[model samples]
Target: MKIDLSFKIAVLLVPIILFDTLAYAGIIPEKKRIIFKGDEQQQVLLIANTNDYPILMQTWIDNGNTQNVPSATVSPFIITPPMSSLAAGEIKGLRIIYNKQKTLPNDKESAFWINLYEVPPTSKENKLVDNVTVAMNTQIKLFYRPTPLANKPEEKTLVTQLSCYGKAHNLEITVSCKNPTPYYISLSNIELNLNNHTYHNETQLDMMVPPFSDNSYRINVDSTNVPQQVNVEYSFVDDKGDVHGVKSTIRID
Candidate 1:
């Protein structure tokens, strides 16, 4: 196992609010994803309750692939506060810690899920209200970067494989994120430069491409103008608190 350079990753948490005829719940966060690594082994997520009454939120980390499923055995690498209660219009910090001493693969990145289940103040007693009056639990991907034992993959690898071309039938242009390498690619801000016009995704999708995966998004712009190139913005957090942002471009022609 080899320790690589450090980076500070930024996860974008968005705002969410729930409204029902009988109840209202809110959990507003700055970002959706969280990165845990190196000396900065912990990240604090600020959660705000915009509701009028108190709400009990259960916090935990689960494997990234598995969803809201409950497991008898818990994950040992990440630790989250068991639970928290927020009053009306109150905000609280949920500290997530990555155990430094724990043994994890140093060759690649591992992913997990962070869950915040908002239990209605009267959930236990009024179970029937769950159908229409309760807010769904919030969850996002939590990534862990293990020290790389070998040469790290480059950002150009993702950029080089991207493409934008129109389909023969519908002429809808599809932008692709093709990953030929073994490393997973977390991608964002994929902008297409066509003829003289440019377009980009507004909201972050938190899209990731597994090794050798073909991922594509359809651009709603005019496909008649052949795409010239694409500008991509990718980022990750190092073991230190530094956040590395890489901007790379790929020519479609």
Candidate 2:
């Protein structure tokens, strides 16, 4: 029996190519999530094999001021045989704990991340080889909302104040009309201004606010692509179809 040299090489390369593709796409087995202990702390978990193939996993905080800091206080949880190598499909856990004192700033409310990088396995001399190390990681977002000290106010008169909290993005403004009168009210138009750029839209409402009761509408502001600013203008129509407007501003850091 004679085998063509090119055919033999192709047959041998198929499995290696497939495995490399799978590892690059992060199809390898792994699990990740943010574990909350109480109100002020949480943990990021990463688990992968580190046997004959060593996987480098990088972890960092994505949202807060403490971004890109390596996992120090948090350690990789591992279980291996005394003298054996970590085989494929084996499991290991890497946990990174985020403490409030370190991860958050004053008045900060939430934290989010993009993704974690899995450094390919390298030799002790840091040379790349045909290793079978897998890259599997995830992003964990932790939110911290402290309990309010005072009693909450009623929502019947719903007073919502919209403002830009961070760097503003695509910015647009909308206003909802509420009629608390017995007769029907009509709204004619709505307008918005930010940093001298004007945005206006026309709308009509055929609604009635019952006696001693109220009707409500909403104002939508889309700031996805707008530059960061401190002022936003909202113009709208009242129940009498008359033009009315309000100016609101927020600080962005």
In the range 1-253, model 2's lDDT, one tens digit per residue, is 2334554454344346534322343313232223233243333332334223544545444542333444332322211111222344344334444444444322322324424555554565544554564444444333332333112232122222321233323343333334332222222233445445565543433222322334433334554554545454434333222345455653443
TM-scores of the candidates in the order shown: 0.56, 0.31
lDDT of each: 0.56, 0.36
Q: In order, what is each prediction's RMSD in angstroms?
A: 8.5, 18.3
Candidate 1 overall lDDT versus native: 0.56
lDDT of 1 by residue, 1-253 (tens): 1211121111112122223211233665434566556346677777777566788888777765433454542554554567788887666677788776665555556667777678657756577564555655677667665545244545555445543332322444555666665455666545655566766644444456655665665555656555455554444433232345666665553
Off by over 4 Å in 2: 1-46, 49-53, 64-87, 102-108, 123-138, 147-253
| The 10-residue segment with the lowest total lDDT in model 2 | 75-84
